[model samples]
Target: MIDDAIRVLAGDCTVIAEDADRSEYRGRVTTIVKPDNTVLVHDIDGYQPVAWLTRADSVSSDRTGDFTLVAKKDTQTLRIAAHDQDGFAHYPTSAAGTPVGDCPDCGGALVRSSGVTCVSCGDRYGVPADATIRDDQCDCDCGLPKMRVERGLAFNVCLDRACESLDAAVKQAFDREWGCPEPDCDGDLRILRRGGLIAGCEHYPDCEVGFAVPAGVVDGECACGLPTFETGSGIRCLDATCDRALEGALETEPTADD
Candidate 1:
């Protein structure tokens, strides 16, 4: 199964499948290449993949302007052929952009190869397209670039682990919106790692507050004077305690055009 977090490269192509029983199936299909090198051929209408090849399966490609990808596993074989010279477009996991910083693991410069991956260690850090990387250092005394991923969420991250700004930034970002939920503790909640959705408290030893972040939460604010996450259901408050408040606001609020 493909993890929700894993991005896929997809395109339209022709697929030919040969089974061990000597049966053959051929059709036009949408091909999705996963990060793990697994290939899935799906029908145009459905989400299910009609044919697939595991990463362990032997794969070979032949290109003559256009390209043909062949995968074989035991007696089963799958072939995907591109009709046009540029029938398929290669969508990289990372967009073309400037380097963020030096790799913390290897000290080599970090480039956006596949979402801010390290050139030396190949460690991938997810930076959304709109993520801001400024030339100036943050106020936290880390002297590292200030990176804000989600716009409405004020969380800024310092990619360098040696810098002490990350915890401080997190504390400031979530201070007014949501503090550490731990009882009798006042530590601020913040994101401990870059490209991750988990938020932990600054007071790790004393108050270990953590939670899974919902999608589309930004550093910006809503009319409710709290940070919000744009979920599929609707806008929701970052504080779980304010769920009922958000629901009530959504029910009463009217949409206005700018």
Candidate 2:
């Protein structure tokens, strides 16, 4: 899906456009919602649900604040915003586009001339080829990952300090399971992914467990017969050859450490 996700500077209160008829907001300038086309918002509830606004004006920490709009409909697109209130700025400020080099996506080394194909991923820039591209594999320095299998599978977790959006990851993990794994535990677990191989159980306040499901990567059919997800339990099989007694047997466990 084309994710129109944006990260604004994060602020207190924010709103987005819900429908074309913004009449309900005629005199309610405090609607806080934005127009359909979300302009740029900074230092408020950064783009999460996406609020469309026009030229935003007047920001106040006080509950009672006024904005500079000729009338409610005059700038109905404007949305009132606030920061996280956690005594910190937004994760990545939007004042200026981060430098490509400094950008986490671009990473450190932007230039690498090692091979034609991406040796690390084996993906050619445009087409698939036999030759190996050495550059971005292991930073321009770590080099391409060799075929030699390590002693144990390192946990699939990415321990990056910056990549800390764990909520969605955890939800995806639970979705992989489709529900809870513990037979006796009937309630249901909330999945939260920590960058590393293990994901945190959504029941953080209570049930704190870690898992190793690759969030959305459908591997294959579990021995049981159900389609196996990255870190899901056994597959659900109904084939005459399949067995439901032994947890269906189709469910595969983590073969490697991760």
Candidate 3:
């Protein structure tokens, strides 16, 4: 209880007279870090950091950058600490930018990938040309979520709420980079990484031409023990592995926006 009194600073005190904690530890507020919720108190003791101080704002302190007072060994001492609103300075969580939250169009689940593009669509999230804007009134009262994805990912925001958009995006990139190179319909082929060089024509059933694959995000395994690539042509076959990949291939249905 006494310690709480010191930390909370119950009374209005004047100057930080003596030392209850670090005797020779007195310094000015140097730099502050919000990521780790720490502060550097600069003084003759060099720049020592005080970490994990909560509610440092509730009370006054000799140190700046927001602080509280503490008493040690019956003497008043200043301690750099955390305040209620300091979360933004030392927070670890990342927020989705406009248009990057739940899709305003459908309220479908959206994620802010840390990389250069949306993990689902592989589209560059930050570029305006790479995406389109809509006056979304569906949910988020504010408007479209902001785009934060960097440009290094070499993709554009599908902004598509359905898994179909994701699948299409992946296929578009893959085909652009590694065309089937087959004659007649080489460009429209689907690359399947089953166990070896697995690929087949997107125009399936009528023109069946399957290959082997070595490794990739598998769609599913056929009854014949062969893995297949899942497409948006509707559910025709239920390859076990393909089912899993298909789940990822589509966007999760979103709920209310905002």
Candidate 4:
């Protein structure tokens, strides 16, 4: 979703900027107002702003066809004038572009609108805009492509429901260092619901192990080479038998240097 703090304007305008030291810069520029009301003036040739005013500064403007805007701080002031133009037009900023691929459900065009959605069947896929689809296939044997969501934060997920990797991907996204907790089981665990704290084993009917995940717990590894989680209670090993042993080792271990 587009943030409410950003305002976009396009048109021909001239800007005159003055600093506290009485230095001045004048140019024809485009303006963008941030959510915090910070004004950014941009030249036609570059992406960076040529002049700016913070939200703390006061601004005044005239609405006439030939308009004037003045922003004032302690001693600095910026004056902008609109001239020799058609008019100003506002356009919504989109981080996502045209359709990435067809919808899996009904073969409809899938485009990013808030979230990735299908234009034909109205199916909503919960993939974030920042996520990227990989060129590889999922291990689930479903021919569909796997999406690498939250590149640095999680693993790839298969969009196909017929594949088992779909469940594995959801769990890996939420749990740091997430994996199957069951002994000798290679399956992974995933959150049972979106925005919920409960996580369950993906190898259901085979490995019945599941647990209630504490809020804000980060999955990690213990000194004893076992999976661990940092909980409010403390850093405890996933295996109950190794918890006490890992706790003693952690207490005596030296912390890593920053």
The number of the candidate with the highest TM-score is 4
- Cα error of candidate 2 at position 39, Å: 53
73-164, model 2: which lDDT tens digit per residue? 34354434332331222221112221112213322322223322222222212211121222233223323221111101111211121232
Q: Which 10 residues in a row give candidate 3 its minimum summed lDDT?
A: 1-10
lDDT of 3 by residue, 93-148 (tens): 33344434444434444454442233233343333333333333223343333322
lDDT leader: 4
What is the alpha-carbon lDDT of model 3 when measured against the actual structure? 0.35
Candidate 4 per-residue C-alpha lDDT over 1-258 given as tens digits, one digit per residue, 9 for 90 to 100: 233434444455777677645544555567776545678778767677877888836766666776567777777787778765434544433334357676555676667656665566655555545456665756654444566643223556765444645445545566534577555988766567545334557777687765554432345556555456664456666554553466655556556971
Candidate 2: which stretches are off by over 4 Å? 1-177, 195-200, 220-258
TM-score of each: 0.38, 0.23, 0.23, 0.39
lDDT of 1 by residue, 98-132 (tens): 67776545676667544666555555555545556
lDDT by candidate, in order shown: 0.58, 0.32, 0.35, 0.59
Candidate 1 residue spans exceeding 4 A from truth: 1-17, 20-114, 118-130, 135-146, 150-156, 161-168, 172-235, 239-243, 247-258
Q: Each candidate: RMSD to true structure?
A: 11.4, 17.9, 17.6, 11.6
Show where candidate 4 strays beyond 4 Å.
1-14, 32-38, 43-49, 53-62, 70-78, 83-86, 97-99, 102-225, 228-258
